[model samples]
Each structure stands twice: as C-alpha cells, then as structure tokens.
Target: MDQNLKIELGKQGVFVTTIQELYNWGRRSSVWPMQFGLACCAIEMIATTMARYDLARFGAEVFRPSPRQADLMIVSGTVTKKMAPQVVRLYNQMAEPRYVIAMGACAISGGPFKQGYNVLKGIDRYIPVDVHIPGCPPRPEALLQAFIALQKKIDCQPLTGAERPRFLDAGAQGEFPVPVPGGHDLEPTSNRGVWPVPITMNRGE
Candidate 1:
C-alpha cells in the first residue's frame, strides 16, 4: 500500500469512529422511555412529560410503547409479584445501554404496599435500577430530577472498551463512595403541592 494512502485511510477510520460516538451520545441524551404505567404513580409520570413540567426540555418526553424501541424504562407504579417476570422480560428486550428509572415510592420499595402479599418489594428486585424517585407518587419535578441524575450517571460512565481506572472497579473500596443522607432534621416539604399546579393556558374563548 502507498504510505500516503495508508495514512489517509487511517484518518478516515478515526473520523468514522468519532462520528459514531457523537451519534450514540445524541441518541442516549434523547432517550425515549417505555411507558409501563401500572398504578397511581402513572398519573404523575404523565404530568412530568406534559407541557407544564415539559420533560421534552430534557429530551425525555418521547414515550414509546414497544420495549425494543425505548432507550429507558420507567417503572411508574406498583409491580405485583406476578408482574415481576414480565417487567424483567420487557427490560431484557431493550437494546444494550438501556436504563431503568424506578419511579415513585411504590416502584422503589413497594411504597405502602410493602406488606402486600402480591406486590413485589421493589422493582429493583427485577431490574437494575439507574434512578430512584422517592414519594408516594413523586412530583413531576422529582421525576425530572431523577432523569437529570440518570443523565449525569450516563455521562460519567466509561465508554465501551475504554480502560477504566483500576481504582474505579466495582469492588474497590473507598474508590466508590456511597452518598450519605445529609440529615433529616429539616421539615419535609409537601411534594404533592408541587404537582397539578395550574399552567396558564391561553385559549381564545
């Protein structure tokens, strides 16, 4: 091979790889979550994607029905023990680099149904959860925050085939620090009041 031709081909390869990475990043940023609403929390999940909260601003408002097409899964309601297998199957059907957001207290830790014989203790038992929104039904803003947190986690994650620092290994103690709860002394804010807030609609009468 001609030396110059070989060098040119190498440059082309590099360009293609860079372009592919950029495309992947764009797709990940604009994740379309599968809408798997099963209970009360579904209402709040819908509101988060609605005009007022505008999940579109974060590129997460696109809700897909098919698991294969969605980049993320939002478990927005109680997952019954009987429903656990189905949830796992749906999660498995999604393409690689998928994420799961356990929305609401129910999905996170079974909420008030923790004692229920039929309710799964938590959706986390069935799927690897990327974010947990804590509330009987978390406010739209809380869900949005969870999405933002998920995005941050995605950004920090190493790309495939990249050599991560040895200290960053999952088993490496101190390298991975668990976040501490700052304190619970502060009065709890009413998250319910944050939801269903009237949005100004100007419809000509």
Candidate 2:
C-alpha cells in the first residue's frame, strides 16, 4: 500500500493489509537466534543482549539452545576447519526461513588467523551468510545494526515468484554438503553452489 493512501485510510477509520505484508512483518519481528558462539566475538554478542545494549527491543532476544528452534545463526568467531562441518550440519537442522549473520572479521574471513591452516577462511564457504559484520570483534552496536539490516532484508523479500528467498522456493537445495576432514584440508574446499570455485582461463590457450 502507498504511504499516503495508508494514512488517508487511517483518517477514515479503515485499515487494509496484504498477507505478504503480515507474513513479512511477523517474520522480521521475531527472529530467534541460536545460542552458539565460537570465540572472542561471542563476548560482544553477549553484551548485545544485556541491559545497556538491550537486543530484546528488536524482538530478537530469545536465543534458542537448539538449532531446530532457531531461525537465525550468528557465527561470531573464527571457524576452524575442524568445526566447519558441525556448523553446517547445525544450519541444516534449522527450520525453514533460516538466516545467518557472520559477525566479526573472524567469522567473515578468519581475521588474524586467515592464513592459519586450521582456520577456515570464511564460514560462507560452506553455508550462505545473509549479513557480514566487519570488525575484529564487532561491537554490540554493530551487531544491533546488523540485526536491523537483516530485518529490512526480510521485510523486502517477496512471498511469491521465481526470485523469492530459498526458504520459500521448493526447488532450492535444502541441505548443504558437510565437508569432511581430508589429509591436507577440508575436502571440497568450498560448497560449489554456495561459494562457487573461481575459474581461470589460460590466456595463451
């Protein structure tokens, strides 16, 4: 509905809204995050829910201990290759309409540990990340900002159409392949569909 029209209708004691609007409104309002963390960034994430920061104001205060009950996963630390598979598996267990926020430089690209053999370059290599908060360990304010950004993204998603989000698209892949530990590295390196392998062409050829 148009903004002016909605206001005019309100003046006339009338209200109208589409199902899509209602659905999106509810979904964006109550995004329960999983209560899981891996490193230093977890401290900032914890602070976000405390009195001063008060993440509950956004209606996302409820942190579920189980993946099955959560819609949001805040990967807020370094993702070592050994733990990458477990993270992906947990994501797979979450119900439809799941979202991920890669909070801090560590979760986004391993931060100072990027070159370390054990640190996964980025969690997105195995699972899709909807929001990326860039900081060694992003402040609570940054996490709140990221939360609002994710809400805006949910609000704009279309309920129907080929371009609809993966959760709403039946043909979309339901589970990502969990990488297995190989001799030198995590086998497959990255999820082909989530993060496609870069292709290079030989100029001489």
Candidate 3:
C-alpha cells in the first residue's frame, strides 16, 4: 500500500486486503475499449465517451483503434453474417483479460432484422461476451451502466494463480471459428464443403 493509504487500528482493521484485490481494483478501474463501432448504436456508445457522460470518470477513457491494445470491445450495432468473421477476428486479436459488451438489440439478437437471412442472430454465438446491453439503440446512460456492471464483474476476478479468466488462464482457447460462405447461411469451415471458391463473372457475354 502507498504510505498515505497505509492504516492501522488498535483493535482491528477491515480495510487490510490482499495484493490480488489491489491488482483487481486497478484493472477494473482502467478498462481500455477498442474503437471499433458497427452501426447506429455506435452513436450512443460514442456519446458515453464524450464530455457529458465522460467515460473517464469510470477510468475507461482510452479507446484504442488496434485490437492488440484494447481490453474491451463494445459491439454497438447489427452484426450481419458478412461481418461475423471480421468480428470474431477482431476478438481473437485482443490481448488477454479482454472483454466484450454486446450493446443494443441488433448486436444482441439481430433486432427487427432477425428475419433477414443475412443477419447474424447474435454475436455471442461466435465469441464469448462479458456484458449485454439492451435497446434497439440504447442511450448513453445504458452504455455507462453496462460498463459499470462489467467493472463490478472484473472486481470479482482473481489476479494470482488461484483463478483467472479461463480463456486466458488455463490454456489457449484457440481462435474463434470464422464462417464460410456456401449455403443459405454461412457455415463453419470445419463442416464439409463449406470452403468458398472465388467466382469471376463475365458481364461482357
């Protein structure tokens, strides 16, 4: 503990805690999210990081454009089948102790477009999600609440060898499987005949 933070009691002291708590506290305080935004919900997400809401208040102000540097990814809009591979690829690129918050109904369940053949039902089908924010396009307040919830969840995590996020601690979880184009719906490459071949159309004919 810092000298200023150090304290003692003649009879007892409840504040005394482990280094793991200290580390978890720090980690929870300063979560850096990726700067990747998908659609309309992105507008509300941006608002949360702005002067009014000030994500800095929660210690998560830096939004890195590179997934390698980011600690959280807020999937803020619709996730179409065409975008699923890219989404999973970005998630795989993030460093350990990473998190993902599915924001808005579109990212959560495809929203009103769930009937659309090209829309992915939800992002969680491909990558593990940490938080799910509701609303077709949730207001900035909702996004802030989601971040706060994630912080609370992070506070419960262990910093030492005892426990950690299984995805990063136990062993390599491997990359999320990217979808391949071949049928009415995209299929995993592991499935037979799912691999796609290049097609060139001769419009002149």
lDDT on C-alpha atoms for all candidate structures: 0.70, 0.93, 0.81
In terms of TM-score, which candidate is strongest?
2
Per-model TM-score versus the true fold: 0.67, 0.95, 0.82
Instruction: Mark the 10 consecutive residues where model 2 has the least summed lDDT.
Output: 196-205
Candidate with the greatest lDDT versus the true structure: 2
Off by over 4 Å in 3: 1-15, 160-163, 189-205
- What ordering of candidates by lDDT runs from best to worst? 2, 3, 1
Residue pairs with backbone overlap in model 3: none
Better of 1 and 2 by lDDT: 2
lDDT of 1 by residue, 124-195 (tens): 654567888999888999999998898877655554334532224544222111112224311111112212
Per-residue accuracy of model 2 over 152-184 as CA lDDT, tens digit each: 999999999987999898899999999999999
What is the C-alpha lDDT profile of model 3 across 146-197, one tens digit per residue? Answer: 9999999988887546466654466646466777666767675222222122
Error of 3 at 78 (Å): 0.2
**Superposition-based RMSD of candidate 3 using all C-alpha atoms, in angstroms:** 8.8
